[model samples]
Target chain A: MEFQGFRRKDGSVGTRNTIGILSTVVCANEVADDISRHVEGATAFMHQQGCCQTPVDIARVNETLIGLGKNPNLAAVLLVSLGCESTAVGEVAKAISEAGKRVETIVIQEVGGAAKSIAEGTLLVQDMVQEASRLERTSCPVRDLVLGLKCGSSDTTSGLAPNPALGIASDLLIEAGGTSILGEVTEFIGAEHLLALHARDEDVGKQILDLVKRMENRAKSAGQDIRGGQPTGGNIKGGLTTIEEKSLGAIAKAGTAPIQAVYEYGIAPQVKGLVVMDSPGREPEILTGLAAAGCTVIAFTTGRGAPQGFPFVPVIKITGNKVTWDKLRDHMDMDVSSVMEGEETLPDAGKRIFREILQVASGMLTKAEISGYTKAMDIYTVGPVI
Target chain B: MKNDAIMIHEKDNVATALRDIKPNEKVVVGTGDKSSVIQVQQPIPYGHKFAVRDIPGGEDILKYGEVMGRATQDIAGGTHAHIHNIESLRGRGDLER
Candidate 1:
């Protein structure tokens, strides 16, 4: 139940000690990326947000950036600002600094221009990375872990094998005192009532129902039926028939744990069991959303191979389809197709997945991370870029 | 049990084909008398579902013991059940409820 991890000064255990270069506005992403390109052990969280239209969206962008900076994975943070963006760079940096992580800020206009900001930002992140490098892995209990769950490009085998296996792993993690976050409220549409039955209380059950309804209504309000788009073409080709069937299969990834809490997109979890967050079912946005919510490790189940990974976290790609496992062997981290082939039991595959999670948390790099396929990611923003 | 097809729940009307099942193939659902053979009506591709019993058009397709969708065409028992034969009933814009 213990893994080697960097213990942050804030008393949180981190699976990775990274220096994050975050943009205060979309205009500053290039500088943030430039800084990360030059600094070792540093990465940029470049998103097309920060100079947005609506007040709610601007506030959401700022809060998500703050949470990402406060995540245990980041040993330090460097804020890259366009100087006049809506996001309050000073306030965000102050909050992160209060949490005991090394925080610094560089403004483009204030520092002269984009070129000047990049120069200053690179030097700052270099110093931060070196400081982060000084931290060493120590004894960290599994209870301190926040494991995020996601399933993408699904097929029938996903529900039959890897998903149930992941569910078992989710339950195992929860029993060991760790937290597991299940997001993608959009996937729970047809199976919302069923999933709600697993909530810890009536209130939580209602919240689960509300989130799914809200997600569906939001699509309807946009003048589009979720059915027209969901159970996507690929899903149908892969044998999925309805949103309910997909949702039924999708919920299996959370295992059999009771829903402990429900949260909005980009918000951190407060309770420690199985928490579900409101997020769309896309990889880049939802993956970034989960990372911002403070999950240090992510387990992604795919029946069709999904290769995207998070820049700041290790993503364990598990597949239950023998065809996909063979075609995308280099991308997948674990192949649990034996469960479907009747050669292995679900619990056995679940135990293997659990062991893989622990090993990855203890410094093992996944195929996606090793192949450097983790850089294209951004925060989830639903509003216009005006 | 090592299964060739699994009924996720007892009330489900469809069972997922664990592998590619040939036409007229017998798929075992449970143990001995508690089990029954569902003869395959067509080549059910791996990971797809088959009608455990005949389903009428316009009827709800049940899976995992819940209404997954509505059948678009009358489906014979053991025939492939997919998007070609089902339409989603949830998340419809014109749905009043």
Candidate 2:
């Protein structure tokens, strides 16, 4: 029920204690990446929606940036700003600082250019990294762990094996008073009604239904069937017949916990136990949203094999397909394929996944982390860039 | 406890093949204490679903005890039930104006 973690001054616990180099706008990504590259124990979050966007999306970018900075995994933060972008850089920096972490800002325009900015940011990041390194691991209760659940590249075994196994793990964590976030609203298409049955109240249930309706409406508004994009070609090849079938399997990741609350994309949960967040099923956006929602660690179930990880949060890739496990050994962290073979029961497999989660939270690097396959990241934004 | 195929819920009319099931193979499908044999009418690829009972055209395809979609054509028991035979009822912009 406990694991070694970095205890943040704000009372949250971190599975990793790294310096976060956050690009405030797409224009500042290179400078931020350069700074992170120069400093050990520093990771950069480079996103693509800080300028030329609707006010709603711009606000979303700013809020997501603040949420990322507030994540306990980052002991300190450095905002790399393009200076003229629409993102509220100063507000983001202040908000992060208020979260009781060291925060600094470097404006590329004020620093002359990208080259000079990178140099200045690199020095700032090196200092922050040194400060972050001073923080030692301490034992933190499972209650402090915020777990994010996601499944991608799903096939039939996904729902029957790893997804349900992960569900058990989520249930275990919740039973121990830990928090678990279920996202990927798009995947809830067909199974929303079933999920609503688990909601703590009628309003929460309605919210779950509404999130699915909104997601489906968005696809319909574009004058296309959601199936054309969802249940992707890989999913279809993997034997998922329709969005409804995919959803029934996907919802198995929620386990049996009562849904505590529902939140918009990138917003952190207010209550503990099980909650839902609105996010598309794509890896880039969902991972970013989960990170922004303050997940200390993420459990990603993939039937086919998805390799992406977050630059800061540790993503543990689990698979239920024997072939995927054998072929993508470098990307997978755990194999619950035994469940598919009926050699292992779902709860037993779930216990193994829960144990792996604790181990990863205690600093064991997942295959994704070890292979450095953590760079495909982006902030989920709605509306067009003007 | 049949290992060849699994019927997740008792109400499910379809079962998922744990391995490639050839045509005419009598596959045992069920979980725990409840199980039944289905003589497959067509090849059911690994991870694919096959109707455990005859599904009339336009009827809902049940999996995991929930409606996954509607059968587009009459699907005989033990035949592969997939996108070819079933279509989702939700998010069908094709049905919209």
Candidate 3:
């Protein structure tokens, strides 16, 4: 269960050593992206938030950025900011520096223009990468692993196969004293009762139910039904009907473990067994939320096909469609389609997936990771642009 | 176990195809007491659905014991139950519907 990994000064273990160029607001995304383009081994964490949000929402944005910079996977961080943006770029750099990683900041307004900021940021990132390359991995136990669970573009086989297989893997990780996080609160609407059964206590169970209620209310107030935009076209073509039916299938990814805790979007889980994070169902937002929560690896289940991965974490894409596996082989990591053809049992598929997770954790890159499909990541926001 | 295909729940009148059913290929449904063997009108892919009982126009198509969509036209056993013949009842645009 030991894998070679970089140990961060904050005491967190990371599978990948990366230098991150983070944009403090939407305005500075171009600068960060430009800087990242010039620097090898550098990834940009760009998002559309950081200005004119309600105080609570602004704080949430600020916290997620700071957390991303502090993530152990990052060997160093460079914050790119627009001088007028409300997001606290200075505070973000201070937090990451305190976590013991090299941290620096570049403000476009103060730096004169985008060109100058990009030049300065690129040089800064190159230096960080040099420092990052000097760091070496040490033996880390399985218990230190933080795993994120997510499924997108679902179809019938998702419920029948990959999700349950992932559940088994989640259970195995938890049994090894690792942390597993389940996200996408909207999908839990119809299946909340099932998940509540796994809560650590009645209060946790109620909290799980309440989160579902809030999601439903948000949709309702927007003059839409929860099912209005669910089970999407791909899902229906793949044979899922109601939100209830999809939920029934979705919960299989949790395996059969007790829910140890629940967390808000982008909040790190305090205790680890199986915890739920409140996140939207979109790939970019949810993936960002999970990574910001400090997951070192992610197990993503897709039925139709989704190929995006995060900047610093390894995403293991598992699919149940043999056709998708063969057709999109370049994008997918593992195929449990054998479960559908009766070539493999659920447990057998689960074991195969678990082994794959171990392999990836030990430095094997996923197909998405290999193709450099990490640019489509963003933090979810609910406010108007300002 | 009848093994033709499972209805998933008692409330569902349609069953998903566990394997591909070729056009005009005959398949059986239900058990001996109420069994019926019908020919597929068109090729239906695996993981897709076939009508278990007759579904008239405007009736909702049930699968997994819930309404997946409403039948836009009469659907018989062994016919593909998807967008061409069924329309989503949950998230349709009013004018389009």
Residues A183-280 of candidate 1: C-alpha lDDT, one tens digit per residue:
98889988888888899999999999999888888766655456547877777777888888898889988888899889999788988999999899
Better of 1 and 3 by TM-score: 1
Q: In model 3, how large is the Cα lDDT of residue B39?
A: 70
List DockQ for all candidates: 0.58, 0.79, 0.20
Off by over 4 Å in 2: none
Q: For each candidate, what TM-score against the reference?
A: 0.95, 0.98, 0.88
What are the RMSDs of all candidates, in order?
2.1, 1.2, 3.9
Clashes (N, CA, C under 3 Å) per candidate: 1, 0, 0
Candidate 2, pairs of clashing residues? none
Better-scoring candidate (lDDT), 1 or 3: 1
Per-chain TM-score of candidate 1, chain B: 0.84
As for candidate 1, its clashing pairs are: A167-A255
Error at A276, model 3, angstroms:
0.5
Order by TM-score, highest first: 2, 1, 3
Which DockQ value does candidate 2 get?
A: 0.79
The candidate with the higher TM-score, 1 or 2, is 2
Tell me the TM-score of model 1.
0.95
Global fold similarity of model 3 (TM-score): 0.88
lDDT ranking, best first: 2, 1, 3
lDDT of 2 by residue, A117-146 (tens): 989888888888877788899988999999
Q: List the residue pairs that clash in candidate 3.
A: none
